[model samples]
Target chain A: MSEEQNKQTLVAQETITAEVNSSDTIMDVFVRGARKGWKVAIDNIIPNVLMAYVCIKVLNVTGVLAWFGTAFAPVMAIWGLPGQAIMVILGALMSMGGAVGVAMSLFNDGTLNGTHISILMPAIYLLGSKIQYLGRLLGTAGVPGKHYPVLLGISFVNAAIAMFVMKIIAP
Target chain B: MEELKRKAVKVPISGYIALMIALVIFSGLMAKVGGGWTMLDFDTLNGKFGLMKSATASFMGQGGSGARDGFLFALSLAPGVMLALGLMEIVEHYGGLKAAQRLLTPILRPILGIPGICCVALVSSLQSTDAGAGMTKALRENKDITGNELLIFTAFQFTAGGIIGNYLASGSALFSYMTVPISVPLAVMLVMKLFGANMMRLYCKMFVQEEK
Candidate 1:
């Protein structure tokens, strides 16, 4: 390992040790974290679910999602996604793990498959680029600086390029 | 930012067109020029489209009801990650991370060429990529990050983890279909290297002031 990275690693190790010796026990840490996790999930998911409900109520009681699918189809088409995967993209982006729920739902209902999986790939890669407040916490916590605004742009372009190339190369 | 925005606005439209054309050419070549697959039935793209349409129609019909039963599959993992990270955060609050970063800050600054204060977003973005983008924006908003540094740091945030995770972990067929071939990690890393270097260079210009 490079000297710099090694130093960072050592520091991380020492910090953990020091923390354990303090008043907080490991169990205390875990409970706190779980509660925080639940909070983050509840906090983010509610707004999204509400938005989806509102969007569903206002946008297309009968075929709003289908229209959303169609609207996203061309964009998804660019990544080889069919129109139907739009909701899957939406589910995943609204909150963490929501997409997996969407995918699982589709899978059990005999909807998702290998081909659909392919179409969803680029969209997933492109999904949550706007994880807004999370980035600020990282900055405050001393994360490196070059990790936010541009990562999505670079990664998405790369993913788009990669996904397209894969489709072409495969068939 | 005003001047920089104005300069960015001046970039030629033709540049965008050229990029789009290149992408098309590359995609076409990928579609037709590949080997060891079904013997060149390009006209049957309609059949592929048809199959996708039928499958998707079925997928949307009752997918949501099934998903509610299985959301727990995801929750199982979130708790562990959150727990571990929370412990780490508590450790940080106690000043362990402060000592650690301080010890390593000098090297980090020279290598990443970023103010140490910006490292939080940079590192957070590294861990969770866009999960950290919000954090990055918050830092920017709080004025904890310098403008040029913010732009530069954001550029470095997604070398591979973001796209690859999206493609593989997010279970998005859209991403998989688009990315598995062009080498998402490679393309992203290349762009990151180039863009990040450029951002750093821009920040290092004679006019920019250092943080106090």
Candidate 2:
């Protein structure tokens, strides 16, 4: 009821309001971050897992991967990997998860060894997101049409170097 | 152009050194010196528990169901990847990335030959390649970074997209299967990716014409 008491009450209300606003901003940042994170994860994982499933089935049923492996065996030999690694490469071209799936199947069957998986892992990581990166991200990003080849070239070159390095040091 | 210009900042050399050191530590290259340090040692832990081994054995025993097993393996990595992406998004939201750009510009400018502003894209790419490329594309569209800068930065991302998160998930998976220390392979990958990026930067410098 006193003037001093009323003034104190007004000041306390303003302080609380300021504190709440600041905390809300921090909370908003975290909530927004979590939502975005989950969105990115789901977007990447679902397609990746699905594609891996399909690739594994196709590899299992068709045996085309084996044929391709035999065909690419010589080239793959240059990289110190077995013919079956073609499956991993093919899977990588589609998605990282697909590559992992293919690698796992090969590992289970005793077609690919630990060294081979080590050699392939980095290459897959480097080039695995190609579909999404090239088709959607780059296209929408307004990169010059001319630069696409250059970008692709970089990815392949990186993969190649990764393969070479991994082959030597994987053990 | 004004917006682009406004975003660019002169990063200090000390900041670059700090970043380089941080990167090395984060990549787990100095594991021996520190008696061992890594964000994920799932492989060793898995070995102790025999979790991954048993899982693989059971999956293999199913026979003709390789697809299902493979799908499950990939799905297993989802949690880590999603968490990484979410953390990155939060960092971006909080302007941590912008601050990093200011600090990392000088270093990136010299090594990758891109402007400092590209650090934002670089950091973004380290969380998710798509996010990085998308951000780079935005920078390019805004003329905040030049065409040459775009190419160089793209090369970097191409080699190591979502570096930390990607490696943590994929690398852990690899280690679980293989017998090597997880950090060794991860270090190898990071080095190779950086090598590829540097090679691309050199290529751009030697071949690509300046966009004056």
Candidate 3:
């Protein structure tokens, strides 16, 4: 074979070896992914879940939730929710899991019906995680200073739409 | 010369198009009718709560119901979140995410009014909005996306943070509340989110100046 052909063959062999060495097997990928996934779930989700549990427990036990719900009942009535749903909204403001916890409690006790859940779920899902989204996510994403208000406005609009649409569909 | 002169025929089927169609159809079906798998249940808890009511109504009363039920419901989400996130990680590790990013870029670019690379950020956002936002920020810092693009993207992320994980984790509670299938609300939320993002896109185009 010509010297040029020989050089090409050597280069090809080296490339193949490098590719093989660098590629992880499916099992390895799966294991690594699973580990990372669990870490994320634990780090991000578990705390929120725990927080929700605690928040609901405290609010219910103290009767503060009921009082707060009564105070906000008129506002909630506008959205077809029980005054107690104020807890869910408050919980959502704090964390997504907290909102879920509140919702679960209310749903289980027959405080908030399916229609209420439908209206609240989309609103909470869309608007929850406020601190993380506003402080960390958008703040870090380098959004322009001028756009902040606009973005906030859009968030409210989305929440409003979710609430209205879900109310119509579920109610 | 003859081979070079031969015309290339356009085929209707493409892998990406097919996948997109399948996803839409599947989501529609799931939304209209409930998913087959019943991943979480409150029946046992209901029975237990009934027994508790009869036996120790005064001792362990309604005061703790919120905490007790909330804790159990949160626990119920664990399995689904673990599985969904774990599978996402595996797909990401296998270059499936990258391939998806590439395939989705062109399609998303015109609709979202952003570069194709934004698809990666969008997909990542589906699992964890924070991570997705962080990734988009990195992309912005690296000059992979513009500020206006960031605004539009953030609009989407903000509206529907952690789409799949959120759905799976919270769907049970939502399902119990609404007689409608979980997918129906999910689909509705997604559409509203997309609409919100596009609205931002239009706003940016009309009002905001392009970053130099």
Candidate 4:
């Protein structure tokens, strides 16, 4: 009993020490976090969104976006999304922000709407950025190479399921 | 890795309060409230840009395309991203995440077939993909989890990896267009993540030959 009490006391002391060590005021902490947010916005969001717009422009100029909309229309109909929405899914595989960029571009051009955006939102993140994450996440975690396909498959399945759920829930 | 463990500090009551407030902010519930309460909402605080001569368009204007349009559009999104992350940071510093870790621990085994020890990595993964993956590697190297458990946890992190950060950051772009509240889709992502993890658990159980 005494040993347990001693351990508790040690833990209590450690907590107090941690509190003392973090001397920044609340406002300071908030600003520090906000700064990190600004960096992400500048570093990742802007460039990626810009790239997505350009890609969409190229696809638009080449008439590929129209072609894709016709080709994928049947498949995307399952999610109540237009055929061009496939581009958002494809973009998500590479980068989540980029997928958002595509979705935004499509929305701007009248190919999608508020409801379509709502449906695609969860699906975008559910399988978002898998190409980069295949190495950054799966490889780093040391999952056997053999199971990579299965992991990716599972994410795709999850994304598919999320779209169905979003379709039901989205207004 | 050890330092990440240090982050599992005792979550004070303030941490719980901070987390609740964070949820309320991101939940979009307060977005409709009148008066000063709007300050508590994300979109309300994000605010709108001053209109150009058209009155209908923001600074980006219309009939634009390609890189320049994308650049201006993305620039328009910058403030929302910054506000979201800044608030996320405040939540982290207040131990909201640690409190989340605490709340998530007990349900870990039931939900993901992983141990409570993984709660830290799970929460970390919700914020940053690299941090979660790095911690998972450490978890495996330390032999804190079995091979199958690692796969399941990785599967969870794999789908919807960095949920909060990615959603609040990039997903913020769609916030205005959504017919539902912001938190609804977030909830959907989280649910799908768990569902995906369980699928992995079943796969590991049925297919893989256990070495142990």
Candidate 5:
């Protein structure tokens, strides 16, 4: 072989050797790992899905929800959101996934329309985080010092501003 | 002596267990007063799909509507997930993240008024929420952080993703103009810069900022 061809052969050999060393039991290891990962995912998915179900489907707490909507009237006015907008924001505060669930519901019901969407998307984007869990989980586990209030407050305020802005530009 | 004591501290297992017990008791009492919990409306999945179909049809002829939906969906996740992957590729290829970190060192020190080394926690948090989880796991494993540091990081991490990856892809089209060559990343960073400064000021007032 010419020098160039010889160099190519050397490189190919190096590649084959690296592949062999890195993935010696590639199929077996990959299969076992995938099985283990799926097992954990399945285990965790049950409680989470169940809790989400309970919060959204079962909690027919419209009385409280209406209160939330009314309280958010000023905030809604900021974004020019209808009173109904607060319901979705309330949904989001409860759970981002849940709020998405609620927003999707409202949009489906024809409660949101037009440039109204652009206004709401930013709010949904902002106020909607997996935040409530942070309070329960982080306050319990984030750190030892009494910074929970500070952390939680900043996150909420940040999300709140995003939502308020969205309420403003909704046509 | 005070500094040494702070470095050596750990939450006693007994104390942590006691706290858990207290929480459980508190939760039980709250539950008893509040009654049972309920489910989310996720089973209304049909409604979600129906909305999508209708929105698509309504905005069918409208210019930029389809593009807006597609763009917003990607914007919501791209900065955190796709960008992280893109960054990993760049780091693997050019070894630039280290350089970036090194360049950021002088600014991170006084910018947030935290230790220069602690900037990695902030950066990692901005990139991915789970990445910050990994950082916390490492810190716990290594016993590197004190209780106070954990609180500080918790506050920081919760607020980190807002400016960077989270807001990068979604709704800034209004600001960026369609198909222009302007810098979206810079725009997102600027938002973070503005918000992050206010956030740090707010947090400092709420908690004691330890001087390094």
Candidate 6:
């Protein structure tokens, strides 16, 4: 590990050990969790969401988003969503927060509404962030490289099925 | 692994109650209740920002696009993220997660085709991806699970890995716009995780050969 990361790890270890040894009140625990949440919101969610918004803006300016809608509409229609919903799915492959960003941008643009958001929600996470998880999750678990495709395929199937289920159940 | 097998934490009855409270908060069932019961809901407690100008517009304003718009939008989600995690931390502190692990042990074998020994890693997987992955590696190195079983468990974790954390933290962005309750999508993703794991199990049964 880099020296910086090593230091951070040491500090984190110290914090964990200290916290465990002490009998903290419930409020202290909540504040600690909230602090972690704030870190996540600032470091991960905000940046990804910003990038997604810029990406959608670029797609809109070039009219590529419209073409995507037109092309994917027929397929996306099966789930009762518009053609534009494909961007959300594509964004989800990389990051869950990005997918939400794309979906929210589309919602703001009047391309999708609450029902569409509802329909797309589970699929966003079901296939959420798999591109990164390939290394962090499957690779670390020592899942053989050969089975990667099968695992990926199952996630895709899960996402597709989830959208269908969401369509039926979304009000 | 021998060293890792330490004594289990004692889960008090309060831990189970905290688990139930966690469920009810995220489930959005309490979102519609009247009077003091509304305190139990997520959205109700997260509340809303003051309107900026027009009746329709809030702090984000309207018709804005691009990164600037995204920044404001994300900022709007900050409080919800903080609140969700704060409550999650409280639940976890009171042994809620341990309570969940105990509950999930009996169901893991039937639902995911994995041994009960995986219960700890499985629960951790829902909150943090790296921790779950590291624990799974330990499980494999210790030979607690077979190769096929590892594949199945990894399949379960790979899709929607970090379910609760990601959902409550990142997924909170869409909570306001969702037609259903906040927890419905989470519920769906979890069920689908189970289904995907089973598919992997079926694939192993049919195609992947077992080593002698």
Please tell me which predicted candidate would have the highest DockQ against the true structure: 6
Model 2 TM-score on a 0 to 1 scale: 0.72
lDDT tens readout by residue for model 3, B14-110:
3245334334432434333344421122221111223343464522244455445444555555554544445444444434444455566678877
CA lDDT for candidate 4? 0.86
- Residues A5-81, candidate 2: write the lDDT tens digits: 34433432221111223454645754655565455456755456556667667766798877887888998998898
Q: Write the per-residue lDDT of candidate 4 for residues A112-146, one digit (tens) a residue.
A: 99999999999899889999999988987899999
Give, for candidate 4 chain A, the lowest lDDT window spanning 10 residues: A12-21
How accurate locally, in lDDT, is each candidate? 0.44, 0.62, 0.63, 0.86, 0.41, 0.86
Candidate 5, number of clashes: 19
Ranking by DockQ: 6, 4, 3, 2, 1, 5
Candidate 1 accuracy as lDDT: 0.44
| TM-score of each model, paired residue for residue | 0.46, 0.72, 0.71, 0.93, 0.49, 0.94
* Candidate 4 per-residue C-alpha lDDT over B95-129 given as tens digits, one digit per residue, 9 for 90 to 100: 78789888988999998899888888788788888
Runs of candidate 4 with Cα error greater than 4 angstroms are A1-23, B1-9
Q: How accurate is candidate 5 locally (lDDT)?
A: 0.41
Q: Which ten residues in a row have the lowest lDDT in candidate 1 chain A?
A: A11-20
Report the C-alpha lDDT of model 1 over B9-70, residue by residue, as the tens digit: 23234334433433332233345555633222211121221223545532233334322333
Which has the higher DockQ value, candidate number 2 or candidate number 5? 2
Put down candidate 3 lDDT per residue, A6-31, tens digits, no spaces. 44334322211112224776566546
Better of 3 and 5 by DockQ: 3
| Candidate 3: CAPRI quality band | acceptable
For candidate 1 chain B, the 10 contiguous residues with the lowest summed lDDT are B41-50
Q: What TM-score does chain B alone reach in each candidate, compared with the true chain B? A: 0.36, 0.63, 0.65, 0.95, 0.44, 0.95
Better of 2 and 4 by lDDT: 4
Candidate number of the best TM-score:
6
Candidate 3: where are CA atoms >4 Å away?
Answer: A1-42, B1-70, B86-103, B170-177
Model 5: per-residue Cα lDDT over A5-51, one tens digit each: 34433432221121223343434433443453334233432232234
DockQ each candidate and list the results.
0.14, 0.22, 0.27, 0.43, 0.04, 0.56
Worst 10 residues of 3 chain B by lDDT: B1-10
